[model samples]
Target chain A: MDVGPERNSLLAYARNWLVGLRSGELGVLPIIGGLLLTAVVFQSLNDNYLTPGNLVNLVSQGAAISTIAMGLVLVLLIGEIDLSVGYVSGVAAVILAQMLLPDGSDLPTGFALLAAVAAGMSIGALHGLLITKLKMPSFVVTLAGLLAWNGVVLMIIGSQGSIIIQDRAVVSLSGSYLTPDVAWAFFGILMVAYSISLVLARRNRMSRNLAVEPAALLLLRIVGLALVAGTVVSVANLSRGIPFVVVLITVLYVVLNYVLTNTRFGVWVYSIGGSIEAARRAGINTDRVRIYVFMIASSMAAIGGIILASRLRSVDSNVGGGSLLLYSIAAAVIGGTSLFGGRGSARSAILGALVIASIDNGLGLLGLGSGQKFTITGLVLLAAVAVDSLSRYGRIQAGRS
Target chain B: MTDAPLLELRGVSKNFGAVQALKDVDMTINPGEIVALVGDNGSGKSTLVKSVAGIHQVSSGAILLNGEPFAIRSPRDSADLGIQVVYQDLALADNLDVVENMFLGREQTNKLGKLDHNGMECRALEVLDQLAVTTIRSVRQPVASLSGGQRQSVAVSKAVMWSAKIVLLDEPTAALGVEQTRHVLDLVLRLGQQGLGVVLISHNLHDVFEVADRIVALRLGQKVAELDRRTATQTEVVEAITFGRVSSVPGQSGATTS
Candidate 1:
């Protein structure tokens, strides 16, 4: 056809843009285009929507969900799902609140945190053992866990109405902020460390005769990261400084992403999801990794529960029973992570959570009812699934052709 | 040459429920040699190799490594003794790159105990170079992206990288094109010359004739004959494997192979 050349050029441009997307980095085109679209639409609709305070509130509110989504990403990576994480978090928060009851009860705050983490881990281990050892499907086991944990929460909080967190340190964890100068100092230090690691990793790949990313690409990454760090610091400076919750979420994001991408455990997760037999042949203790993954997911839930309760200053029996589960899974999927597993990143969950929060915030500002919000979320979920399936089909077709 | 055979299996018998997969099979592999294991389907080639690689325990037999009796309690134990097996399907994770597949369970780690990608990748490249497998340009590329022959090369390299005393390659060229088969046969010879005892298991006589230094024939779970490559013809080895005995062959020994 006479239009073949034009079509070819369009395809070439698309290919180049696709190639630039990697884990932990947003493609520039989509990000820029999205920002422009948001500004155009929201700035015209509501004057207060794009203000710095609301933006700060958005980040703070999204952090807890994002942190929990990070853990859910791990569960999904190995081709498994933990339907109980939401309720587990709720139960964890309930327990934490109960521990701070009026009388001389339970352990200190630090010990209680550790104990909560342990409880979550044990529950996760139980799930793993049931799945692998008993040959029960994870979906079934986790589904049962979802109901069981919810029931436990109800039983624990029975007739007590709800418990409130009064500890100053615990409350400050979600509500407090750093001084402006200290926030900048910390941001600078983190950027330096990240840049150094990136450079060293690139060099290591080169030394191994592995294909190294182009110098320009690597430089672009460093500059991009520095800019992001600077932007975050400035945003915090605009508000009441960086919320301690943001700092906590950022630390978990960096550390957890590092473990998932650079470590053997991360590789094992993908390998198991891709092919369990292959992982076993490679001498990885798949059972152990599964157990460990569940533990990590549960522990994160415990941390999430604490933060959520601190933000609310109270926990009820039904705190995590409802839409939290769907939202967490949605966060993971919206961030472009695959549900079928062997593909995805922890960072995507954070990004996805932000996307979810944006939609929620935008709709709320527009005074949309819960039904309309649900419809929008459902449509987004369907769109994500469609994109995932199309891309997967494309890959398979490419391979076959 | 080493006075002791690198690996020796005596009366290795394995049973699966009611089926006698390998009934009293015996084989020996010396250092710096390529031994072809030829047999028909259900001829117990897999059973013999599996026993040697510790994937299955022999019901009754003595497996010796370097003239010392070895106990293979598990696959890890066999790997520790430098006995490696590369199966036909090549149990490699496609999502993982060549270096990751090669080092795999034995990935190199630095003092921090993290995956030493540099060390593993460097060692993998070196092993590929030693195998003379030049088809692949990037070791960082996932094994999924590789051609059939290249994947085979990576699998063979994984077995040979740790200085395996005996490397068992099962049907390395069975699924390959003619050109890939040639490349793989060359790799087999290269591995042998590198002083590792290589056992090439295949049904293709042409491939055996091309690279194997010796031929061991098995029929119906029993080793019937063993022939030196220089002394026996292709027809002679086939007859021995198919009929359980050599009717006419000049220089080959007549003793029971197992």
Candidate 2:
């Protein structure tokens, strides 16, 4: 193997993975440490914080915000933001509720869902058009959208405070769970597929004489994942089984991660985010890509809104009100997505959402109100950003090294 | 010298409002030739390159490619015509790796349309090997970490990767050290040997005279002089760049403004 002094050393690899001092990556240590730290603090306050049942409920609660944040990652990747996502999602939920109102159109659940996503897509397209064609700042355009879409929600849900969703399918979206047997089976399938791919990749590198992890280390990595997966499934069995909402969020993560890392469109999104001028010189249609990214952001927002409504079994003008939008954005940033663009992952959105949701979940158990929850969450967000900025400086120094 | 030129600019003029950036410019670049474009700052050297790259449509005249009239209305048209440019300040993204930057807009895709990473890596390796660029430690290393000369090499390699008939490099070695400058000069000569029309825009006369087959000078948006490198002296080229063949100026002292 063409192993340089630092390239093939298992110790170096592990250290780098932990701190990323020499690698430009944000690293896994801080994220894991933060999660564990949160667990410890909350568990001390309320013994229920670390329980299997509470943890499963946490995933269901985090799914919608995580999904919304995931969509925001696309926009963030290209160095933009969608302030209207919360309201866009709110509008979609209202539309879906109206479609499923039995006394009204009484549309099929699938069609109603499609319509919500479509509405989000159209709204995103509009935002893109105004931002690009009119040459308006995205901040202003999305800010206007935030207010305008909130108005749309209010107009649609006028007189009635909320549209209660009586449809079984819609309600089941957030409440449904996979049985223990099915959850375990799915976990098994995933582990098998994941292990095969990872093993084959290592073998491929070995064949090429590239530095690769030792077989023992590779096995350890696989075993580690297996343990985690086992714990999650076992916990789900202990609770009400694995929530389908969690599965949906995970599926979204997998799909988006693949798309961003492996597709032409995905590369362009990063390129545009990196430097629009450079991307333009490279013959990329920057405007078109930007528009599409916004569209994706909104479409995902629609899905998030649906999840929220499904959980509550209703939609109202206040669905996306208060700190939901800010929290969603916060979740993405806390998960490790950069605000300045050109760097982020779908994993960040979900992980960040999990962190945010945990704070809320833990606080609720202590009988704390939303005020305390918001204050703590806001402080956490600030700390995350401070670390991110510090890491950015470290990235620069690491690049020099 | 008997070969027909690959690119010809005839009386191409460009005006941005009342300010004329390029005026009545004429030039020719043939296969297996190196043309050095030299001038003071704002002397239409960049304007002419930008015009050819279709960043600014010529207000008048025509551009001929491969002896055929070619209309370049946008940068894409220029790229489609096998013309590539490595800009001075921003030819690459610092966050992306060499392979990603090299194949930014024109990524090779698989049957399912995902990035054909293996294919691209092989091709990238082949291209780097062809250029004899041994400085890069890994293709996966982000561009931000690369030395200035290494980044320049990747940018030039990107132009070569796309099968460009003509390559325009704007100040490729302005930020490099002496050794790096020598390396880039060698690469420019190598491009000429490979039968591509290479346009080297620079402020360094030593560099231009070292590799360029001919020097084209511009002054105040006009083509002032075209000289054969073998016959031309440094003074003559400098004079052409500053004075434009006019023995003396009527204005106070001979002010040479950038």
Clashing pairs for predicted structure model 1, backbone only: none
Candidate 1, residues B1-258, lDDT tens digits: the string is 447788888888787875667766778888889999999897789888888888899888899887789889788899889988898889988767888888766766667767777777778878888788899887876676678898898888888887787899999998999998888888888888888899999999999988888899887677888899988998898788777752322224575442
User: Per-residue lDDT tens digits of candidate 2, residues A274-294?
Assistant: 778888888788899899999
Q: Tell me the whole-model lDDT of each prediction, alpha carbons only.
A: 0.80, 0.87
What tens digits encode model 1's per-residue C-alpha lDDT throughout A1-401?
34566556556645755653322123233324433555567668888777767777777777768877888989998889988899888878887888777677746888777777778888888988998889888899999999999999889999988887887777898888888998988888888888899889998777766766565565677899889878877876887878888878888988898787668888888788766788998889999999888889888887888888888888887787766777788888767677887777887788777766766677778788999988987777676666666665655544410
* Top DockQ hit: 2
DockQ of 2: 0.52
Show model 2 residue runs off by greater than 4 Å: A1-9, A15-19, A22-24, A199-221, B15-20, B59-62, B246-258
DockQ-derived CAPRI band for the predicted complex in model 2: medium
Best candidate according to lDDT: 2
lDDT tens digits, residue span B135-181, model 2: 89889877888888999999999999999999999999999999989
Q: Which stretches of candidate 1 lie over 4 Å from their true place?
A: A1-45, A104-107, A202-211, A398-401, B230-238, B245-258
